[model samples]
Structures are given as structure tokens and as C-alpha cells.
Target: MDKKLAAEHLLQDVSHYHGPMIRQMKQLVDIYIKLAELETRREDTNRKVALPREIRSVKQLELVPVVTATIPVDRSCQYNEGSFPFFRGLSDSVTVMNGINAPKVVECFGSDGQKYKQLAKSGNDDLRQDAVMEQFFGLVNTFLHNNRDTWKRRLAVRTYKVIPFTPSAGVLEWVDGTIPLGDYLIGSSRSEGAHGRYGIGNWKYPKCREHMSSAKDKRKAFVDVCTNFRPVMHYFFLEKFLQPADWFVKRLAYTRSVAASSMESIFTFDDIYPLSA
Candidate 1:
């Protein structure tokens, strides 16, 4: 063979050998990038879980169960008639409050003059007339506030023993009997006002119940309720679930990625043919 032709042939052979290897290397690099992304996600989840409860931004107020009584529904009214009354009432109140710009804390008075006298003595200028009358029917402002405060007290007591950075599963189990911490944390249970069911805290408004029971309106009601309330429930549940450390660990596992180097170690051609050679 001619020397030049022989050299050319050898060069072509080398190119053929390296072409697939280059492609494989590119694939390996892509895999590594994916792996790194997965690792970063895992780290973020772990960090979120490790964060202290106080710093987590999951407010106790957010977990407070919506007051059942405050949901307006007239038993005598038809389902469609009462279905949206609760939201309407809220909107009305917001409009009034916007117009009034009432202080964050308002002094409420009973029928008696004595209550008004006491408030006046306290020098509270935020007092409003007939605050109770101003409130949406069936929705008592004080009752909701009181209930929220009570829930906070209970939650604070229950969570007092929960050590920071500890797995929430055991703590949840320990407090399960006292409060449905596990249920709320996991959000496995359906929420009130979900699926056209206007129930909250084991009781549904009589009008809502009647409406939901009607076969003709059931599907529509579900759609409306889910549309209006599902997002609220989702937000609340997600916040609740992330409050625990175990969830963080679970999230990391769910999003974990294999490193590129690890993949290369298992499948690289360097093992068969030394790269140095």
C-alpha cells in the first residue's frame, strides 16, 4: 500500500471510533445536568423542611378552620337561591369596610348602654354603631375572631412539644387524637365547600345541604363550589403539609436525581478502553 493512503485509512478509522464516543459523552453530560437539577431540587426541599416553624411563613391563622355558622344559607330558600349568598355577604362586607375603612380592631357593643359607656371610657375611637347589625346575617365577626383565637391557643399548646427539624410524622401521630393535625397537614380529606358541598367542620348549612342533595343541581353545584373553594383548600392544605419536617424529606425523595458522574462510572467506555491510552 502507498504510505499516504495507509495514513488516510488509519485517520478515517480513528474518526469512526471517536464519533460515537463524542455523542455518548454529550448524552452523559445531559444526564449529569438533569441529575444536578434533581439534586438542587432535593436540597431545596430539605432546606425547606429543616427551616424552623416560626420562620416557615405558614401562619397559624391560615390553618384556622372557617367558621361554619358564618356561611349564610337560608333553609327555606332554594339551593340556587342560597348557594352563593355566603360569598355575596362577604363581598358586601368588604365593600362596606372599604367605604368605612374601619380600624383593624373595632369595639363592638351589646344592646345595653353600659357596654357603650365602657368603650367610650376606654377612649377607643374605632367604635361603630350596631356592629352586629352591620355584620352579614349568620356571620358573627366576634364569634369568628374568638374561634380563631381559641384554635391558635389549642394549636400552640399542641405544637409546644414539637421539636424543630424533627420529622413531623411522629409528632403528628402524637397530636392526632387531640387535633386532626395529621389530616390538616396531609390535606388527604376533602375540604368544606368542596365539590358543591357547602359543609364546613362537620356541618353543612341547611340550604346548602338541600341544594347539594338535588340531583339536577348537584353537578353544577360541585362545579361552582370546586371552582370557588378548591383553590382556597389547596392553598391551605399545601401550607399545612409543608409545616412538617417529614414532608420535606418526602419531597426530596420524590424529586431526587442521579448524578452524571455516577452514570458515567457505570456506563463509560473508559472502562473498556483506557482514555489515557
Candidate 2:
């Protein structure tokens, strides 16, 4: 994923009118090898495509690259510097989602609205919700520009949903490299529905039951995964469990987790973070 991102960065730095010589090097290398093999196999046998007699005439990048076991886009590969800052990846086993896939699910609701009810029942409330959220996200500015009540209700639902997400404000960031969370993440422990104080993602108000007061501690309430939870993962005790979740939005010049102490952190930082400065 980071390799693709690095390639993207490099591509952007180059041209739209024409491809860069560095990128063309990939194809050039492959073609060069094929030509060399063809030449070797054909001391007596001949092929239509012969190896170019004068390789020096091709003023391409020095194709005789130094050998390395890994794709070194680090301090060593000076040309790729800042292009792909290599980082530790998830255990070579897990399939993590890259940002390229922003899946959009569209479902129509007839006047009966039975589809929404059916989806909410057939263990697909998440699908219904995401579709609704996707539409809400798509046309809000225009929706607000047109009608007042519709806009307020829309905004109200959004705000209410985010009431729990506020805990994850830890993930929201601003330019100049500031974590917008302020002090919200310190004491919050998110559970079903509301993000408590440490959770992320939109809360399903109908499905959520939250408490942050002393009662949560006094009642011996433990964060447990209930059968009703949408994404279907086991429960977690915030004090003991952590997952390093991350996403970027708002085209927002937000910083990302450069490093983390654990996998549960919503937004982590290390030395290389705050690179924006």
C-alpha cells in the first residue's frame, strides 16, 4: 500500500504531458532483459527482435542497478527519498484495507420504506446505514443550500451520530500538525453505540447504550461485544485492549500515525510524525 502511495507521490511530482524516465525504467528493464535472453538463446537460431547493438546510445537511467534484497526506499535509496518512506507492516498474514477502495452501496427505498426495515432486520443494518450515510455525505452542502428544515434535521442526525464519535476526535487533526482531540481521549472508554471516550466510527443511536460517569465503574460495566454489534468483532476492554485504527479525510492536511505503542491506538505518533512542518 505504501509502495503504491509512494508511486503516486512520485507520479504526481512528474508529468501529465508525459511519463517520467524513472517510471519508464520498469518497462525498460523488463524489455532489456528479454532482449538479452533472446540474444543468448540465438547464437545460431534467430528471432525478429534482436538486441540493440549499442546499449550506450540509449541515454536511459543507469540500468545496472546495485543489487539489494529488499525494495530499499529508505535513507539508502536517495532518489526515492520522501517518495516512499518504508514502514513496518501488519504481520505478513492480515489483509488490511487500502484507501483506494471506498465502497459505495446503493439501495432504494420505495414509498413503503419496507426495504429499510427488511435490511435492518436481516442483519444488514450496516449496509442500510452506510448507504444512508453515503447519500448524506454526498449532497449535504446542496441539501443545506436548498432547504432549511431538511438541513437542520440532516445536521442534527449527523451531530447526534457523532456524539459518540467525538471520542475519536483524537484521530481528527488540523494543519500545522496538531491533534484536534485536545483532552478527550485521556479518560474515555467507548462501548456499544457511543464511542465512549476512545472509540471511532459512527454510532448507531438505536443500537447504542453509553455511560461515562462514575456509574460505569460503580456498576461493574464491562465493554463486551453484544450480538447486535454491526461489524461482528469480539468485545474489548479499553484499559487492556487497543487497535491502531487510522484514516484520512477532509483532503484535510492531517498527520498520520508515524508509529504506535500498540495496535489499538486510534491515532499514534512517533518521531517521523508531524512531517508537515
Candidate 3:
């Protein structure tokens, strides 16, 4: 064929071969652009949708209420036993409870008062002494309980139910438990142990010994599998168990410290006022 005719024929063949592919590529690009636009629209819609007022209000509510009571220091009062006095002025009571002052040292004329006096005297000024420590710890416990709601709110803590995987089912078949997120996030020994065993150990299997004639061969295969699997299992355990456990523990410790600091900031020695003489 002449050069001009040959070149024309070659160009025709090239277009014939590449025409469908070029058309398909353009269609794919159009589809991708449409998908990108849809995704952007979806994100914008999500951002614009506000939470319902009722749900928002419920979220704002405290997880638990502050529990406080008028614990009487007076043993002589007839109604002191198993009786919690309700003050009319809630604000005044809170002020008294949280006010800063040295703890009141009341002289006990009765037997109970005498015992209180003796206990206090034994502790002297050392809050760490047995009797004083008990009192201090008791107060600390109350303080923590009272402010639990505050800490939960500050941390934006939310509860969720988690089901764990069973050993036989493996991760694919594992179901989450129905426990509250608050409880699960606390990182109990039971949860940690279960996760460690199932996530790391469940995949390990004994060697198939049907083809092996010698016991030594079977044993060697088993040992080899176990040895090779150790690092993989260790990595899974660290990723799924140890790291999460550490994070949970640190958060809990921080919450406790915040609670303690909150208590210290509000309470004073004077708040432990002496009972009426």
C-alpha cells in the first residue's frame, strides 16, 4: 500500500480499537463526579440537621443527682438515729456544707459525745490517723458521690452496650454484650480477660496429625504453629486489649482527681461545724 493510504488505514484501526474504551472512561469520570457531588450534599444535609430539643435537653440532664444529707454531729438528739433532717432553705444548707472553716470541736456532755471527743483527741492534728482517716475517707467518698454527675457531664461520657466475641465463633461471629458503655469503659477484669482470650487465643489451633506417622512430627508442627502465631497474637492483644485498657484507666484516674479537686475547692475546715453546745 502507498504510505498515505497505509497511515490513513492505521489511524482508522486505532480509532476503532480505542473508541469504546475512551467512551467508557468518560462515563466513569462522569459517574465519579456525580458520586462526589452526592457525598458532599449528604454531608451538608447531615450538618444542617439539628438534634431535637427534647433529646438535647435529655442529654443536658445530669447522669446522677448530688446526694447530700444533714448528718447530725449531735448524739444527744433523740431524733438523730436513722433520721435525716430536711432543711427548708436548700441554698443555705448547701452554703453551710461547702463553706470554709475549721471543723467544729464540740464538747460532748453525754457518753456518745465523750466517745467522739476521745476519738478526735486520739487522732490529734493528724488526719491520717486511724479514726481521723476513717472520717476523712468517709467524707471523701461522700464528696465523690455528690459530684459524680459533674464529672460525667464534663467528660461528655456516654454509655453503650458492647457484646464480646466467643472463643468458638471468633471475631466474625462475636456479638456485643448489652452492658452500659459506662460500665464497659471502666475496664473490668472480666471484660479484659474475655477480650484477651477471644481476640488473641481463639485463632490458635492444634496441628492436624492425620497424615503424620510419627508423634514427633505432629508435635513439631504444633510447636511451629504456636511459635509463629505468638507475635501475631501478641500484637492483636496489645492493640485490642492493653492499649484500650490503659486509656480507660487513665481517664478514670483523671476523673477521680477532678472530683477530689472539686471537693477540696469547695470544702473548708469550718464546714465541719461543731454541733450546738
* Per-residue accuracy of model 3 over 1-277 as CA lDDT, tens digit each: 5977997687668768666544543343332222212212222321322222322222111111111221445677445323432211111000010012211111112212111110011112332232343355456656545687744544322111111111111001111333333233222333343333444543222222322344567778667555543432233334444667786665565576666555553444335654343
The stretch of ten residues in a row with the least summed lDDT in candidate 1 is: 87-96
Total backbone collisions, model 1: 0
The TM-score ranking, best first, is 3, 1, 2
Number of clashing pairs per prediction, in order: 0, 8, 10
Q: Which stretches of candidate 2 lie over 4 Å from their true place?
A: 1-19, 23-27, 36-51, 54-56, 59-277
Model 3 ranges with Cα > 4 A deviation: 1-130, 146-242, 269-277
Itemize residue pairs with steric clashes in candidate 3.
101-269, 101-270, 102-269, 102-270, 103-269, 160-181, 162-176, 162-177, 163-176, 163-177
After superposition of all CA atoms, the RMSD between model 1 and the true structure is 32.8
Candidate number achieving the greatest lDDT relative to the actual structure? 3
Name the 10 consecutive residues with the lowest summed lDDT in model 3: 90-99
Error of 1 at 172 (Å): 17
How far does residue 261 in candidate 1 sit from its true spot (Å)?
A: 37
Error of 1 at 130 (Å): 52
Each model's lDDT: 0.30, 0.29, 0.32
lDDT of 2 at 207: 38
**What are the per-residue Cα lDDT tens digits for candidate 1 across 38-135?**
21222232121122222222212211111111335568744442243111001001000111212111111221211111000011222122232233
